[model samples]
Target chain A: MLKLMQNEWMKLWHKKGTWIMVGILVILTAGMMGLMKWISLQNMGGEMTREGMIQDPSSLGGTVLLLTVIVAAGIVASEFSQGTIKMLLTRPVKRWKILVSKFLTVNLFGMFLMLIGYVVYLLLAMLLFKSDAGESLSSWSVWSKSLYMLLLSFGNVFITSTFAFAIGSVFRSSSLAIGLSLFIYFTGSTISALLSQYEIAKYLFFTHMDLTQFETGMMLVPDLTMPFSLAVLAVYIVVFLLISFSTFIKRDVTA
Target chain B: MKPVVELKNLSKTIRSKKIIDNLNLSLYPGQITGFLGPNGAGKTTTIRMMVGLMKQTEGDIVIEGVSLRDNFEEGLSKVGVIVENPEMYKFMSGYKNLLHFARMHKGVTKERIDDVVRQVGMQNRIHEKVGTYSLGMRQRLGLAQALLHRPKFLILDEPTNGLDPAGIREFRQYLRKIAETEGVSVFVSSHMLSEIELMCDRIAIIQNGKLIDIREMSEARESFYYIEATPAEKAKQLLTDGGFTVEPFTDGLLVNAEQHQIPDLVESFIAEGLQVFAVQPHRKTLEDEFLEMTGGGQIAEAYAK
Candidate 1:
């Protein structure tokens, strides 16, 4: 199983599209950071304090989470579209191992992409918005929050990637997976907001995926706990992965 | 001889349509068995089941005496398969693809990978991305992947489906070599009759998910002969009258007879004032046997139409 995982890693590395998606994440994240920094500089007036003018690095987590979702969707969808899953499954390894390998690779890619995004965010914030009247460097508490947000961002990415993987396993079409993923990611908050009036809507996977908000110490519903949301997200991950693996093992690879 | 692979009443149905009926087949080791069938004749499905790629709706497949459904992973480990187009990561080089598969199998070393690359004659181009390879090279790469683990049994569906003449010949030679030297039980499904005739030691004819016939090529070819004459109908009648079953052809009549009876047959034709333009022995090509066993072109046309 470990060997199979290693093979999956090699396959992920060899795939050109995986790298292309990563490049896109870096470019988009860096581009957004650079643009935000420039905009903040332009708004700086005579009375503007260094603290007000400096771009908050914590906001970088939001952009990283968004990029992670997009990258995860692409990685899961492209394998099915390219028909590489056939080769992977025909090996001597177990079916579940194949799915687990793919899941691990996608999560690893998500983490790598997030790291790249954070680095780019730091670079852009430092180069474009550095202050002569330096504000105190971010406190340990702020860094801890940022780290927690990053971890939560990964969990969010894993949940979304697993969902996409399940859909892609069933549909085996990249376009459909991409369309569904985008719909869920972009329209999820609006749908959640509308459903907030109802009791059951809060329990949806989309509602709990926003781990960033939890890390920022904000809760739309003060009664809802962070541990409860995390637990629900964990359940979703396990169920999605189980379904994906089971379907892949049993489904015929006629394509 | 102990069979390397056996299917007992194996069947598959998709969406209430039975693709493979109660199919029974046994493939022995050290023999190249050609699975001959037309398109959509459940050849691919049967091969898929043998390799554990697809499950059977009814019955079971036993690989090396182990039930495929019961111990799928173990059964699969003993078998190497290439179903239809051997799809690989197009962006990855051939060497990388082999290496990746090699890692999945226990005891597969760098040397073994190199050996397979050399065996497939892909050593020179193995480092190039598979997308850049020609159809023949890709087929070779697929073959290399199948052979990477040195499986006791190898299952290939339409192994030469898209190859050119030269590629087909190369594949046939390689398969023959593997079957003879390594003693691997090779089950290859193909539509090309002549290729199978030359390549397989035994041939299994399948029609509409049924195992119609499984016979040694020599034994099957021995009972049939193609004889050319001016009037094929008369020649067929004469052979039939002489206690031999005959099938009329466009240019001649194919006679089912023994080698010793050929001279007498020609003499009888000459005595009857019917010119025997050609009296050569006719071997039943895979195509001829497939057509005969499947009830000719009408069944194929009905399916197609």
Candidate 2:
């Protein structure tokens, strides 16, 4: 299993697309951070501070969601597209092992992106601006919020990759997988808002996607809780994996 | 010779339509076997099932005494394969690609990677990215990857697809060398019959999902000579009278006689007042036999599409 994961990791790194995705992540994060800092510096409504710049919402969601969708969508769909899936599947490994490794690779890559992006943006914010958020930027609340944002980014990546991975596996079209994943990411909040009247909307995976919202005690549904949302996300993960692996095991590589 | 791989009554059905029907075939060690079939004859389907890329509707593919159906890991570990185009991560160097594939197999050292790289003659550009490679170069890199693990069985589908004649000749030699030196049983599927004639020891042909024939490439061919003599009708009569079957061709009489018998026929032609221009041996090419077997449907054209 470790070997399979290693192979998957190697393949991902070898792809120009993976590096391109990372570039997009870093550049966009820096760009978004810079813009937000400029807005804060204007000091029209809120205090402008270096520590304040690190707390932008784009760390977890927004444009980063597109990168996650792409990374996720390309995980399995590009294998089929590029015909490297045959090379992978022909090896002495279970289909599930390969699938799991790719799943692991995408998430690990996402985590890496999150951690590095956070640290770099943190450093850049400290270097570029002066802060008055607390006695120091390392205050417990700021650190806690940064950690919360980390969890939220990971949460978003986990859901987006699995959903997109499932779509890629079943549909075998990266464009379609990415297109639909991004569509859902962009519109899900509005859709969930419209559907919020229904009691069942609270259990929807998208309703809990913005994990940072839960940290602020702003539950989209009154009954929504972190534990309940985690449990729901867990179920959705199982469903996505079940669909991806089952289809992969059964489908013929005639093409 | 022990069978390195065996397909026992393998069948595949799609939507109630039988695509591959009860196919039974076997491959032995230290030999190259060609899988030949016309378009939609289940060649790719059977190959897919052999490598576990597709599920067989029935039966088993046994490799190195392991069942592909019952024990996939054991069966597949004994084999290395390249199906359709030689697809690799184009962004990676040829050596890195081989290294990645080597990770899938146990005990595949860096020595083996370099050895296979040298074997495929990709040393100069092993560090160059695959996207910069031509089709032939990529095919060589693909072969290098397949050989990296020193698998007991090697399967190549349309391996010579984009190679030129020189490339094809070199690739064929490498396959033969691998089979002889490593004792690997190689199964190759190709529409290039002339290539199969030179490269494979035996050929298993299929049409409409049924194994039509398994031909030995080393089979003794019919001895035929084209008598290029003038006044050929008179000479043909003399040969027929002398108890030899003589058939008139476009430019000469085709005599069903061996080389040792050529001198006597030449003498007879001289005796019949015919000018003996030349006698040319009529070599029966594999293309003629393949056309005869498959009813003139060009198999290569199917894949060319």
TM-score of each: 0.88, 0.89
Off by over 4 Å in 1: A43-58, A62-67, A74-77, A130-139, A215-218, B220-284, B297-305
> What is the interface root-mean-square deviation of candidate 1?
1.7
Which residue runs does candidate 2 get wrong by more than 4 Å?
A: A48-59, A127-141, B227-255, B258-280, B298-305
| For model 1 chain A, the run of ten residues with the poorest summed lDDT | A47-56
Docking class of 1: medium
Best by lDDT: 2
**What does candidate 2 score in Cα RMSD to the true structure?**
3.6
Report the C-alpha displacement of residue B135, candidate 2, in angstroms. 2.5
A147-172: candidate 2 lDDT, tens digit per residue: 76777767877798789989988999
Docking quality class, candidate 2: medium
TM-score of chain B of 2: 0.88
Q: What is candidate 2's lDDT per residue for B1-305, written digit by digit as tens?
A: 78999999998889999998899999999999999988888899889888888999998999989998788888888898988788988888888888888888888999989888888888899999999999999898888878787799999999999899999999999899989998999999998888888899999999888899997888898988888877766777788898888877778888889999888878877877889887999876888777778886755556667
Among these predictions, the greatest DockQ belongs to 2
